[model samples]
Target: MGLLGFFTRKPHERAGFELYSAAVGAARRPGFFAGLGVPDTLDGRFDLVSLHVALLIRRLRRDAAAEGPKLAQAVFDAMFADMDVNLREMGVGDLVVGKRVKRMWEAFHGRAAAYEAAIDAGDLAALEAALTRNIWRGEVVPEGAAARLASYAQALAERLAPQAMADFTRGRARFDVEVPA
Candidate 1:
């Protein structure tokens, strides 16, 4: 059986979908929110990462019950760690994506050991707010980060927003075109 067996998706299909979710989820984490220089704390309207995670978990629970629990947990695990690395690597600056593949690995898994799990619902919120404020902004990201992010977003839309994804994948999505120099 393959990874998709859990979702009744074909093996290859499931692989893409899983990567899509994982990447999308990571992109929405507080780290990502901070990347755009957004404030850490607010009226809870713009914390896209937390909002999406909550909604995703809720919807998954409603849709899949038992399986949703496992999936949600896995996503939470992966996102929290991925977000951390993305932030940490940015701190060193002068990044260029292609060069830090190995560093990305150590930061993703190893750095996770340094932080504690969310102790409570409120604690999670506070933690996210603090980290978002301290880490995402005021740091420089390596080259290709934007394209990497775009790829994840594209994959996510492909999986969840099939019609939109299809349009974008086919080069029909709306965007401002830049003329070459």
Candidate 2:
């Protein structure tokens, strides 16, 4: 409510950006593009980021601490803000930026829902299907590519589950799960 409030951010806001940073880094790891077969194009990269962010959000929402939901929302806001900046930087006309971001948000939402349901069901096939549909764009993927990505995601979730809520709130995200080559 003060003038400085405009200049400074809340702790959760910083934590959310940190978490988003981690997700972007994880998505850029070469293992995904070379080993697991995600395409290296812009859309492919965006999908990978979306997938990682979705996983992180899912983890946060399940946190035992009440701060989980608030942090999760922060992460979501940070994502769209970054996307908006990215679009403008890419020379997208301002008139279309909102529409583009809206479409991206819809894509993110669908991917998140599908991944969540599959993970909750413990169904690797369903996960693979979702990955193939979204990441691979329904094309015939390289052999076992989608399956490998699904395995990696499941393992990453397992790794994320044990991290303390405090680590996230302190902007110390840990996303070093081994990607199955």
Candidate 3:
């Protein structure tokens, strides 16, 4: 590759990382665990991140612009790459890293599919059920927790869908800052 190519910023790459960062930011909102009763464990955190990323990807897929698909794929790739780094940092051995990453990918795909279906159906009940099953890991959730999270996800999706692709590519995509009480 030429020096110019090396130095030039790739729009999709920037957008992908931006989206992932946004997802992480949303997931880290303390209210999700404190007010909403989402477990504060590693798996719980992963579930939140997965949910946010799935919502972003869903919006990207629905976009009809020429760059949508490419950007979406880049975002997905960025997510897995982050997951790989995280696993390694947690002391996962090289020999099993590939297997662990594969499992994470499978989990992501499953969550994405379920989220897409619920969002498409436009049913809060379906969204709540999906969150309860996946994020809460099938345990009995505190009253209204799933419903609150479902509302948050729907609000986030609505906010993301109307954003211009250029904003995302420029690393200016925004998620709602207010966490549900």
Candidate 4:
């Protein structure tokens, strides 16, 4: 840690925060809840954001560069910070906020692991099941909603997988818009 390191902004850190913001923005897209039938509640929204963040982290981890891990950590940090702020806004007490944040971290990790495994296996059905359980909370969802959400996830992953690391580092990463069928 040198004086310059402290003074100058790191590229990975900046990119990670930008990526986090992008994920949150994507989750807030009304199409998912309105058109796709994802629940609009807090848990539903968190699951969607977690899914987006997991995808980004997965891509970053696949990069061979040393900056990949740093950027991933930064993204994770940004997510928890956002969660903490959200919890506070929802009237969570300061004393119990730590416990609630810990639980949220656990939920995020569990969802990420499940999603990664399903994606790695190349099983769309598994991914759909995971989404149903996590996003829909094991409840019966509207017909085709789970499948449509699964398709969106797959499409989004495909779009993200080919993005240039240079573009990502420059905070120019793009996600596909949900086109009406």
Q: Pick the candidate with the highest TM-score.
A: 2
In the range 23-55, model 1's lDDT, one tens digit per residue, is 354434554444444344421222334433433
- Of 2 and 4, the candidate ahead on TM-score is 2
Error of 4 at 73 (Å): 1.2
TM-score of each: 0.31, 0.96, 0.92, 0.90
- Model 3 Cα lDDT, one tens digit per residue, 1-181: 8778988856588778888888888899999998998999988999999999898888888888877777888788888999999999999999999999999999999998998898888988999999999998977698899998999988888889899988876656687757787
Q: Candidate 4 on 1-181: residue-level lDDT in tens?
A: 7778878865577777788999889888988888767889989999999998998888878888776677888889889988899899989999999999999999999999988888888888989899999999976688888888877887788778888778777655576658222
Query: Comparing candidate 1 with candidate 2, which one achieves the higher lDDT?
Result: 2
Residue-level lDDT for 179 in candidate 1: 12
Q: After superposition, how far is residue 98 of candidate 4 from its true place, in Å?
A: 1.0
Distance from true location, Cα of 29 in model 1, Å: 14
Clashing pairs in 4: none
The candidate scoring highest on lDDT is 2
Of the candidates numbered 1 and 2, which has the greater TM-score value? 2
Model 1 regions more than 4 Å off: 1-46, 92-181
Sort the candidates on TM-score, descending order: 2, 3, 4, 1
Worst 10 residues of 1 by lDDT: 172-181
